[model samples]
Target: MHVFLTTERLGLRSFTDADTDDLFALDNDPDVMRFINGGRPTSREAIREQTLPRLLRDCPCLRTRSYWAAEEKATGTFLGWFEFRPLDDHSPAVVELGYRLNKAAWGKGFATEGSRALISKGFTDLAVERVTANTMTVNAGSRRVMEKAGLSFLRKFTGDWPEAIAGSEHGEVEYELTRADWQQRR
Candidate 1:
C-alpha cells in the first residue's frame, strides 16, 4: 500500500478495498454526515460497489496523490480521509483541500495537522500555485480548521443543492492560500 503523507498523529495513505468498512462507518454517523448528506446514512451497497472503488481509483499516489485515507499513526486505526487534488488534473498547479474525520476524532487537531501537512507538500513539493477549500458557511468547525491551516477567507457563494440542510439557505464559504501567501507566512 502506498503511504502518501504523515502528520504528527495521523497517517494519510492510499485507500484500498479493505477500507470500505471504515468509510461506511464514517459516513453512517449522523453528526459526521450532517453537513454532507443531512444526516442520511449512505447505504452499504453503495460503499461496497461504488464509494470504495472510486476512492481507490482516485487516491493512488502514483497518479495524482489526491485522495487519502487518514489513520491514527499510533494505533493504526482509520480516522477518515483527506483530499488535496487539482480542480483539473491537467492544470495541477491549483488544488482543493478537504477532509472528513470521524466524530470521535473531532477537536483533536487531526484535521488541521493533516491539512497543514498537505498544504506544505503542495507548495514546497508539488509545485502547487494555489490551494482552495470550501465548506457550508455554518460549518464553523471546518472553517476553523481551514484558518488554522493558514488559508485566508476568500468568499461566500451559493450552490444548487439537491437536498437542503438547516443552513443551506446561508450558502457556503471559500478559503484559499496562494503559493506567494504561503511563502510570506513561512
Candidate 2:
C-alpha cells in the first residue's frame, strides 16, 4: 500500500481496489453514515463505481490523490478515510479537509490527530494557504473535532443537499484554518 501521511496513531495511505470490503463495512454502519446520508446503507457497487473512483482520483496540484485511506498504524485496521483536497485543480492555495471514520473509530482522537497532521503538512509542504471543512450544524462531534484541530468557525449556511437529512433544517457550518493562523498556533 502506498502510504501518504502518518499521525501518532493513524496511517493515511492511498486507497486500493482491494479495499472494497473494508469500505463496504464502514459505509454500511448506520451511525457512521447518519451525518453523511441519514443512515442509508451504501451498496458495494456504489463503493466501487463512485466512492473508490473519487478517492483514487489524483489532485493535479499536489501530484497525489487527495483522499487517504486511514488505518490504525499499529494494527493496520481500516478505520475510514481522510480528505485534503485542493479546492481548485491547478491551485494548492485552498484545500478542504475531511474525515469519515467507522463507528468503531468514533470518540477517539483519531479525527483530530489526522486533521492536525494534514493541516501541518499543507501549511509547511503543500503550499496551502487555507484549510476548510464543512458539516451539518448539528454534527457536534465533527464540529468538536474541527475545533480541536485548530480550525475556527467560519460560517453557517444552508447547503444544496440533494437529499435533506435529519438536521438539514439546521443548515451546515464551515470551519477554516489559514496558514498564518496555523503558524501562530505552532
Candidate 3:
C-alpha cells in the first residue's frame, strides 16, 4: 500500500484500481453526495471506466497534483478521500485542499484531522505557497470543516457548474491559507 500520510485516526493513501468499489460506495450515498451531486448516484460503469482509471492514474503523492483515499487505520474502513493538489498541473506552489467523507464518518473530526495534516505537510514539506478550497454557500458543514482546517474565508463567487442544484443561486465560497499565514499560526 502506498501510504501518503496518516493522522490520529485516519490513513491517507494513493488510490488504486482496487479501490473502485469503495469510491463507488462513497459517491453513491445520498447524504454524502448531497452537496456534490444533489444526491444523484454515479453509475457503476462510469466509475469502472472513468473515475477509477482517472484516480489511479492521478494518485496524489506519486504525481504531485492528485487525490488520496482516506481510510480508517484501526479497522481499515474506507472513510472517503482528501485532495491536496495544485490548482493546475503546471503550478505546484498553490495547491487546493478538499475532502469528501462517508456519512458514517460525519461529525467525527476525521475531515479536520486529515485536512490539517495535509495543509501542514503541504506548506512545510511540499513547498506549497497557498492552499485553497471551495464549497457551495449553503454547505455549512463543509465550510465548518474548511474553517477548522485553518483556511480563512477569502471570497464568495459563482461557478460555471453544468447543472443547477438546489442552492446554486447562493453561489460558492472560497477559503484559503498561505504558507506565511500557516507559519504564523504555527
Candidate 4:
C-alpha cells in the first residue's frame, strides 16, 4: 500500500481492498451520512463500486488522488479517511479537501488535524495552488473544522442538492485556502 503522509496523530495512507470493513463501518454510522444522504446509510456496494474505484485509480486523476486511512498513530485504529483531489473537470491547482469519519470519532480533532496535514501537502508536495471544501450551510461542525484547518470562507452557492436536507436551501458554503493564503496561515 502507498502511504502518502503522516502527522503526529494520523497516518494518511492509501486505501486498499483490505480497507473494506473500515470504510464500511465509517459510512454505516447514521450521523456520518446525515448531511451526505439525509441520514440514509451508504450501501457497501456503493462504496465498493462508486467511491473506492474513483479513489484507487492512478494519480493526476483530473489532478486528484486519495491518501490513506487516517489511523491513530498510537493505536493504529482507522478513524476515517482524508482526500485531496481535483473537483472533476476543474482546472489544475484546484483541489478538494474532504474527510468522512465515524460518529464515534467526532469532536476529537481528527478532521482538522488530518486536514491541516493534507493542506500543507497539497501546497508543498502536490504543488497544488488552491484547495476548497464544502458542506451544508448548517453543518457548523464541518464548517468549524474547515476554519480550524486554516481555510477561509470563499462563497455560499446554491445547488441542486440531491437530498435537500434542512440546510440545503440555505445553500452550500465553500471554504478555500490558496497556496498564498495557506502560506500566510502557516
Please name the candidate that would achieve the greatest TM-score relative to the true structure. Answer: 2
- For 75-121, candidate 4 gives per-residue lDDT tens digits of 98888888777765444578888898877679999999999988887
| Model 3 pairs whose backbones collide | none
Lowest-sum lDDT 10-residue window in model 4: 59-68
Candidate 2 lDDT, 42-110, residue by residue in tens: 999999999999999999999898999999998999999999999999999999999999888889899
Worst 10 residues of 3 by lDDT: 56-65
Q: Candidate 4, which segments miss by more than 4 Å at Cα?
A: 61-64, 88-92
**What's every prediction's RMSD, in angstroms?**
1.6, 0.7, 1.7, 2.0
How well is each residue in 86-131 modelled by candidate 3, as lDDT tens digits? Answer: 8766656888888999989999999999999999888878868999
Best-fitting candidate, scored by lDDT: 2
Model 1 residue 114 distance off true place after TM-score fit, in angstroms = 0.1
**Which is better, 2 or 3, measured by TM-score?**
2
TM-score for candidate 4:
0.91
lDDT of each: 0.89, 0.94, 0.87, 0.81
- Candidate order, TM-score descending: 2, 1, 3, 4
- What's the lDDT of the predicted structure labeled candidate 3? 0.87
List the candidate 3 regions with Cα displacement exceeding 4 Å.
Answer: 59-65
2 or 3, greater by lDDT: 2
lDDT at position 85, candidate 1: 76
Higher-ranked by lDDT: 2 or 4: 2
Total backbone collisions for each predicted model: 0, 0, 0, 2
TM-scores for every predicted model: 0.95, 0.98, 0.95, 0.91
